[model samples]
Target: MSGRPPGAKSVDQLLEEARSRITRVTPEDAVSRMADGAVLVDIRPQSQREADGEVPGALVVERNHLEWRFDPESDARLPQATGYDVDVVVLCQEGYTSSLAADALRSLGLTRAGDVVGGHRAWVAAGLPTTGGPAT
Candidate 1:
């Protein structure tokens, strides 16, 4: 049997859908948003994060726990607890996962949720600063 369910689209289709639903921003736009107080959520796994470094002020939240922590009703694990109303931008190793993560946030009622267009790769490619380890 194939991995796809009945009536389900292929990975390409899913990606296209995610792209349509997601609001993409460049690293420069992301910088402006961060300066203006938007929360940048890094959803890349800990291992990848360590290897690739991180954006200077990004919040490290594993992808699995993101919805609960940012949902407002639930007590957030992070020091900075945020509600769904917060302006949030999700990032991953590449642009793909961020779009999915951003869509999930929107489902949780974050109207302003979005993702970095090219994620950390693009950020690094654009010459943005990255921290050596997990954010403190």
Candidate 2:
């Protein structure tokens, strides 16, 4: 028997559910949204940023603190956490984690939360601007 409870969902199921709740964007689409004032939030850890570089102007809010930083009602929120209506696009090394993170933002009432289709890798592959680390 699998160790999980009878009704417990698998990680894949959870991911799918999370993804269904928010729209995912392509790297190019992400750029367009950014140009239109959407915030591109990079949720990768420092170690990964050091190894893979980072999007030139993406906000660096690691996954752990994401909820607090983006929750407009939280005292710990960033100044930009103006309200639930702000457009927030989260990114990770790959697309997987960002989907989940974006869903979490949606739960916090950030109606415009979403993620990049292929994450930072796709961004780099698409020739979007990045900084630090070795060139891909």
Candidate 3:
């Protein structure tokens, strides 16, 4: 007995589904992967990144164009979208959106894609390398 659109999954359900499909990394772990040549992609909008600060080497790919820019067969793909085996770590202001983005990337055949747990905020907290970013 709810006044709502049919077949609309709640955000909670969506989050659960997304997280189940990916192994999210901690901020420290993310930095470790970076050392090993993984790509840390920050999907937070420009405004948020400017406001909070940024991870120095993290690529700002934004959320909307991720699929196209990361798809191996797409012309819009970024140079870092090297191949299907590349480790792509998605990040946002928090962990939530990155989970969804990681899942999306996986669906696009980026099997190694994942997210940074707690996002940039956690990155800052762990004393990882970032520039002009959030105050942890």
**Which candidate comes out best when scored by TM-score?**
2
Q: Per-model C-alpha lDDT, please?
A: 0.84, 0.94, 0.91
lDDT tens readout by residue for model 1, 50-88 = 888978899989899988888867766454546656888
Pairwise TM-score winner, candidates 1 and 3: 3
What is the TM-score (0 to 1) of candidate 2? 0.96
Question: How well does model 1 score by local distance difference test?
Answer: 0.84
TM-score of each model, paired residue for residue? 0.88, 0.96, 0.93
Candidate with better TM-score, 2 vs 3: 2
Give Cα distance to truth, residue 77, candidate 1, Å.
6.1
Give the per-residue lDDT of model 2 (tens digit) for 15-112: 99999999999999999999999999999999999999999879999999999999999999998799999999999999999999999999999989
Each model's total of backbone clashes: 0, 0, 4
Pairs clashing in candidate 3?
Answer: 52-133, 52-134, 53-132, 53-133
User: By the lDDT metric, which is better: model 1 or model 3?
Assistant: 3
Best by lDDT: 2
Error of 2 at 81 (Å): 0.6
